[model samples]
Target: MKRRRHQKTRGDMMKKTLLAATFAVWIFNVHAQGSMTIYGSIDSGVTHISNVAGTKLTRVDSGNRQPDRIGIRGSEDLGGGVKTVFQLENGYVTDTGAQLNPAKLFNRGAYVGIGNNFGTLTFGRQNNFMFDMVGKYSNGFLLGSFYAFHPGNIDDLTNAGAYDNAVKLVSAPISGVTLGAMYALGEQSGDSARNRAFSLGANYAAGPFKIAAALSDSNNRSLTLGQTTGIRTLLGRTLISGSAQAPVYSALATDKVRSVAVSGSYAMGPALLHALHVQTDISVAAATATMKSSELGVNYRITPANSLNLGVAHTSLNDMSWDQLTLNNVYSLSKRTAVYAQALHQRASGTGTVAAVNSFGYATGQRQSAIRIGVHHLF
Candidate 1:
């Protein structure tokens, strides 16, 4: 009887220990549950251009829809409503698996931050306040890369094109509103004031109305292309003055650039409307000018997996003007995959000028109209 009692006690102890271990695992899963995820996207398409200067109707592969990318992100719970997070993302070419920009690795985004109930503070290369505020309501976001506004003409102002090495602070949402501010350090060797930029932005969403506003300033940078006049002999005209430079006029003065924008959106059921007004000022060393741009768009959901978009924009330069119209259709194949088609038409008000802005190459002002069909998938 003594032996049997001792064996039973041992069995009971083992069962209790197993139950305790199971409970501990459940507790850990509930409290210490954090995750790291890997994600990526691949976008590619075919494009056709019309009205080339010296080329016939050319059909080529489009590199605009989605430059391929891979990314990894993670978060760790620090208790008391705080968390530490990090992200590393890089862009590449899906057709060749080559780095997008050979000069830099992880060219898209690389940042670390702390997040909590208050807000988030991040440092490293990231999107600026203007991009966050204005880019969200862009027609490019809806019409893909075929739209004239995809690049948005901000490359010459900020480093990494649209993003920069900066520190950003975001405040928590209050009454459906949030605000962000950012500053980029020039970090020059002796005169740390050569290439500095700063921005402030705010976003608010109440009921069915949403609004955003932003302001940005950059010192010692040329933001927009200007016109250059030179005497040339063309068709027996003795001192012909025309736009002699390409997209970026090389001989013009260099100075600071400032930009401000306001945007708003409204959504009801399956239809959404958006509008934006942006102004850019060029303070040249000798002459100053301003550019104004405005966009209006609407999107309608035909079904749970399909959407239709239309947009129009007009931009007035110092000496020239242009208008663009875009039409797009998107069909979702899955939660993270979609196929899209876009058609854009742009009109210029000059004798030999076209409203063309190139994001990946330097062949600006060479295309008149373009159409694209593409697929985008995210994982």
Candidate 2:
């Protein structure tokens, strides 16, 4: 009788343990509930710019601190130290009511990923490591957006930067250090190297200082002739003799483009200092050339709601040189709204130099100047 009783007790104990385990799993799932959010920003400005085709131009422009955008982002907990994340953002011009890129929606960002404590792995359209690091650490971009980018945006440190069909990975910060990498497919059949691109980078942040370094490499992949690609837009009018008549890809023939850059910032009391340097090398079937860009700037917080920014930047492409100075001020009306004013002066000097103010396009002379007053709101 005692033996049978012992056997029954053991069975009962096993059943209790199984029930407890099932209850624990249910609790974990309940606690891992997912969440979603919708957010966006709108920025507009009145801009007066000069030295374009021997005429002074003035107009209403969109996006100063940031491009006008509407986005949906969310995360879903998948239990056991894993989650699903997604973001879809679109850019637009507030004044004209047109999409920033007429060819596609979500021109800014569209990505989905799985993430946990280890890191995040995402897929879809994204930006290169060089653009991500420089935008965060360079004063020209951090303070003034397009007004602060290097000439022609040769280093791709502005709103014009993006990569299609990409995979990106960013490691969780460990001990004030973080690392990220990205690879973009050129999508041309039968030629894997035609438009493939890749980037690697690392960043460190400690106390009031932050620094980042990145490297990128890309190739021309389009098979179609004469369709303007990223490479053509970046090197416009700077091509070697007789190359302009040829399609950019044919003239360069799968040109290999590489770039390396470093940027950093330091904070002291109410003032912050920022600096960056970028170097680019382009190699093609016939010739190779190098471009170098540098910038130094400072931002001072005059009060809780007001700030001032000043910066000087220079870029050299082959034999041409461009130098610029900018002053900007911003005042906050609320936590999500602000107003700003900025002034810019640039000079291009050399035998064939022309002053170009990035998004403003090429100027008629060696000197160019611009002024902008704008407002920004976030929701």
Clashing pairs in 2: 194-220, 194-221
For each predicted model, how many residue pairs clash, with residues at least 3 apart or on different chains? 0, 2
Q: Tell me the tens digit of each residue's lDDT in model 1 across 188-214.
A: 789777778778889998988888888
Pick out the ten consecutive residues of candidate 1 with the lowest summed lDDT: 226-235
Candidate 1 residue pairs in backbone clash = none
For candidate 2, lDDT tens digit of each residue in 1-379? 9999999999999999999999887666644566666798898999999866568999898877887889888888888999999989889889999998999699988999999999999999887888777568775666865767876565666545578899999999999889999999888899887778998989999999999999888886222112211123233432333353342343444377788999999999999999999998766565666878889999999999999989888888677788989899999999999999999998988775678776675676788899999999999
**How high is each candidate's TM-score?**
0.78, 0.83
Task: Please name the candidate that would achieve the greatest TM-score relative to the true structure.
Answer: 2
- Number of clashing residue pairs, candidate 1: 0
Error of 1 at 328 (Å): 0.9
lDDT of each: 0.68, 0.79
Top-scoring candidate (lDDT): 2
